[model samples]
Target: MPGHAGERLILTGPLRLVPGTTEQILSRLADLGRTVSTEDGVTDGLSVLALSVDDVVLCLPTVIMDGRPRRWPSATVDRRIDLTSYAFAEPDLISAYAPELIEHLNVGHADQMRQLARHARPAETEGDIAGVQVSGLDRYGLDLWRVDSAGAEQVRVAFRQPLVEPRSLGRELRRLLDQSANTSE
Candidate 1:
């Protein structure tokens, strides 16, 4: 997952050390427009260097066995690094690496979600399941805000079948509303 700065670049598993000095590796990363930084840490039985650039963080891992750098069998590097805090702040960088994320965060999805919210029906229950408001919607599912006496509860409902078209979403909403109505009765 070596995408742009804003997009997620997920690297999993062990990484084989490149045939070069530490300085050389760092230089290579710099050439790729990354601001390289080193931390004294071990990740997945390997010496890890934290690389940061344009608000993106990546791990440069080296294989170390028996207190020495050893050659790995495979060239692939895999390690779990949590980058939830990192964000793509630059639009140009995001477009270069992960254009799909840009598309997802676009106005079109917001508009669709707005439309879905307008069409959402009230729940028939008198308890916590008060009014059913479609708060957010994506290709996968819809997020619902179940307004109640206590507070607004968030509920996400994934479609049982993949919605191939926009019209299908309306049908699914109707079905969910009907099911809720029946359950309340």
Candidate 2:
């Protein structure tokens, strides 16, 4: 709080952790008579920032709207957020190497992306399928970028269950791909 003026501060993380956390921070800010602005939305393609405070690891997404960098809305993230004082320090394996994973998926697996895109929504996948790419990956799911003659759209494809470790990412993704392929046949 040293460099922060408490002006228009935006706190974002997993939705479960943010609201309660914001309440606590707001309480402190109220003591100083400061004001803040907060917004919420559902998105999975935002950039992530990992924060390690004490023993807790928080992976927060950052969004850029209207060509300006902005903090992601508080409602974007996987479930299960702790509210107590430094409850768990468990590592977020997915977030740790998301950039590399996303890059690999996008560059190496275009056909699979198209297959996975089949599960997005009938409307979303109805256009003249131009291209598909994996834009974001989290423990809960994958956010796909689908471009068609009409335009570009974002699609969310969730895992069967929340992934607990990095080793399962490939398995979950494979399961999704296989399921999608089978559905199309």
Q: Rate residue 185 of model 1 by lDDT.
A: 61
Q: Write the per-residue lDDT of candidate 1 for residues 44-153, one digit (tens) a residue.
A: 23233543433333433445668965443444354444446444232333233234432452334444333333334344234433455454555567676655566676
The Cα local distance difference test for each model comes to 0.49, 0.67
lDDT of 2 by residue, 76-99 (tens): 432333545344457678877788
Query: Which ranges of candidate 2 are over 4 A from the true structure?
Result: 1-67, 70-87, 123-126
By lDDT, who's the top model here?
2
RMSD of each: 16.2, 16.0
| Residue 94 shift from truth in candidate 1, angstroms | 21
